[model samples]
Target chain A: MTEEIIIAGFGGQGVLSLGKILAYSGIMQDQEVSWMPSYGPEMRGGTANVTVILSDDRINSPVLNEFDTAIILNQQSMDKFESMVKPGGLLIYDPNGISHHPERKDIKIATIEGAKEASELNNKKTFNMVIMGAFLKIHPIVLMENVHKGLEKSLPQRHHHMIPLNEKAIKVGMKKVKVIHDYKKLVAEE
Target chain B: MEEVKLMKGNEAMAEAAIRAGVDAYFGYPITPQSEVIEYLMHEEPFKRTGMVVLQAESELAAINMVYGAAACGKKAMTSSSSPGISLKLEGISYMAGAELPCLIANVMRGGPGLGTIQPGQSDYFQAVKGGGHGDYNLIVLAPSTVQEMADFVDLGFDLAFKYRNPVMILSDGAIGQMMEKVILPEQKERLSNEEIIKHYGNWATTGKPESRESNIITSLDLKPELQEIHNQHLQNKFKTAEKNEVRYEQIQCEDADYILVAYGTSARISQKVVQLGREKGLKIGLLRPITLWPFPKKIISELADHAKGFLSVEMSAGQMVEDVLLAVEGKVPVAHFGRMGGMIASPSEVLDAVEKEINKI
Candidate 1:
């Protein structure tokens, strides 16, 4: 199973970090992983992005022409990557940022106020964790336990207490996203 | 087993480097090729395989690190785009002059200045003809597919060591950024550090110079005759490489009336043009050069006998096409098709150029 996901947002949104976590989790779950970042000259205050592909099988290419799933953290990100999503794929958008919901009917669109919900936990960065949890609940490609361990390793020691908070954020997101059944249609679901 | 998986050429090159048993990676982050470093950074090949990986201060530092590691005969590589490569030319010329083997991958982007981050193949002259000011040629391997991205590492390093010169895996942004399927080779056989040191450690400035005379590695030759001799020797090695390492993919060329010369990312697009030209009953064929330095000039020269006209297609304006004319040597008129400044020459555009050329005569 190999899944390609793109996480994008404005600067300082931790979009790159979220992509790194998925890459880390893929490695932890005994899969070949490749995480690619898009930072061409624009260092800060610019759009940031990361492409993460996880496969139980060998990974062939790290460049993705079309992503199987796209998780957008802001309106600009959604607008940027919405065109590159594979048909009938999963797109998780933060409702707080995206004013216009995507018009695609073939793909499953879950526009959630996940960021607003995550900010309730006193950290807006946990919005990615919230999206990650929704990703796990709906897709469940990697084991929740493995992802938890990956988060533990990736998260700073100071935020060790936020582990529970992240977990809860995932649960909140899991409930809101549309549960996808066709495993073949998604990624890494052989 | 042959398999297909969608991948970008840059990522595939990184994966291929790992498979090629690259011992160390010292490079600065750059566009169109950053995916290679990003892959190694997160995958942390060093943690898994104990390979040395460092993001250096500058491209200058990165190439020097390669020079140092290659002196020890260890498998080391550095990747960069256009402008960054200009800085490394001095080091590359030095690596050749000093007789060190290393791998350098350049996913070429637009040139001159900070042109654009998008992909362009304007570095052909810089790569094949030698961008550095010296009389030396790096074995340049240009891959047309993602598989070649992985496959060229083994080939690039092999040629580099065989000739004792730095070799380049020349690819562009289209190949770097585009996704394609590739089958990875098993990397069980790798050169150990001790083995590397044992092979080339004698010259490596390793706590020595007191026991024996100092071993100075430099390209400077005060005597004109000595410099000419050195140039001749370098030319001889290049001739051997040219004889031994010429690689080209020929398709629909069995009875080809017209030949198309292309390489790397441009080759993939040229393939479709060959088919489209064939469909139009043009008796057209394509020759995709896999090795840019050890060019398949001999083959292209031979193809000139039966061919009416040769069309050289490239992403750059007309760098590689000059080589085609050199190879053909007016035996057949060599035309060109290209889209520079980050423009990709599509299949239809190539076919249109061929058709227009055919109508000229």
Candidate 2:
């Protein structure tokens, strides 16, 4: 199986790290993976995006224009990536600070109030973890056990203390995600 | 110990150099490739394997440092981006002329002069044709995957010493910055002074023993006749390398009507184009030139005997296309398609170009 994903948000929103976690998890699963970041001076503060591909076989073209999934964290990313999702693909975004929501009828649209959830957890840094949990809830591409193992592998030893907290934030995201549109059902209704 | 790890291409190259027992690495950081030096610094190869890692005063100093270490028969390397590579050209020429062995990696960015910091393949001509002055050719390796980015470090060093010529790893920002899983090589022991003297004693400038005269390392020859002889020697070495080191990969080319010629990151992208084109009933193939200098001209010429046409896909405005034209020798139409100034073309866009080329045929 192959999953091509794009994770996009503000530079400081942990977008790149979120993709890294997925890539690391893929490695733990003995899968071929590639993470290509849109790197430049803009990575300091501007809109940053990364294309992560995980495949059962060798991966080709790390940089792709279309994605099976788009994890968007900001409105700018939402505006730019909403049209890039493949037909019947999934798009997950944080409702916080988002003035525009995904309106495509040909794909799945889900929301996780990552900002509010992280605020409730009293750690805004866990926002990406929360969003990751929501993505796993919608599509369990990599198992939770692999994720924990991947977190241990990716995060430094000092950050190991926060793994449980991050795990809890992911569970919170899994429980909190609301699917606003299901493309299959929409197509059925049509 | 050998282990699997996910690493960026630059970091993989640096880590591979350490594992390959590189004696020293001197470099000045540049965007898209700074991680090579940064990874080397963080790993502290000196602590791990007695390797020296230094941030030189400038690109010139870094290359000259490589020249010095290589003259002593020590495995040495340096890396930089486009503009910084331009600064090191004179030193690179001197190294080539002196018959010094070293590795130089240009993680290229778009450029005429300090162009965008994003990935680009505009340095194709600079790498394969000869960026440095004088009549010389650096063995150029174009890595498409992070694994190759790691593997080529060892291969580049081997080829450098085998030919006593400077070898270049010509990659773009895309390959340098992207991350993928790599099997870190087994750590090899660095060569000792005694080992250097034993292995390269005849040519190396190791402390001379009473048995031999002092070895001089210089590219200069005041007499034009002697200089011509030296140039001839270099040319013969290059010709030998061309016979032995031309590396490339051909995918689905047995019955393909159209073949896409590309290398490095462009090869990776064109692979997808081949898939998409095949899905649409187009007989597309890909020829990725791993050794860009001793280019796979023979294979292209052979493919030209069967294929309907060829398209050279690069991130530059048609650089490698000239090589394709030379190889095809007008046997079939050859076209160039690319996006310049750090803009990467999409698979669909590239397919469109392929179709246009096929239509023209």
Report each candidate's C-alpha RMSD, comma-separated, in the order given.
7.7, 1.0
User: lDDT per residue, candidate 1, B1-361, as tens digits?
Assistant: 5543445678788877877788889999888889899988877888767778899999999999998888766788999999989999999999988878899999888775888886788999999888887888989999876668888888888888788889998988766765544577776345765565475455654445466776566668899999888889888998888888888888888898888888876776677677768888988888988888888888999999998999988877799999999999899788988887776665677789999987774
Candidate 1's C-alpha runs over 4 A off are: A1-190, B1-6, B188-194, B197-215, B223-225
Q: Ten-residue segment with the worst summed lDDT in candidate 1 chain A?
A: A179-188
**What Cα-based lDDT does every candidate model obtain?**
0.79, 0.93
Pairs of colliding residues, candidate 1: A1-A188, A2-A55, A2-A188, A61-B7, A63-B8, B5-B181, B7-B180
**Interface RMSD for all numbered candidates:** 7.4, 0.6
What range of 10 consecutive residues in model 1 chain B has the weakest lDDT sum?
B200-209
Per-residue lDDT of model 2, residues A1-190, tens digit only: 9999999999998899889999999999999999999898788899999999999998878888899999998889999999999999999998888987788999999999999999999999999999999999998999999999889989999999999999999999999999999989977888
Top candidate by TM-score: 2
**Candidate 2, position B243, lDDT:** 95
lDDT of 1: 0.79
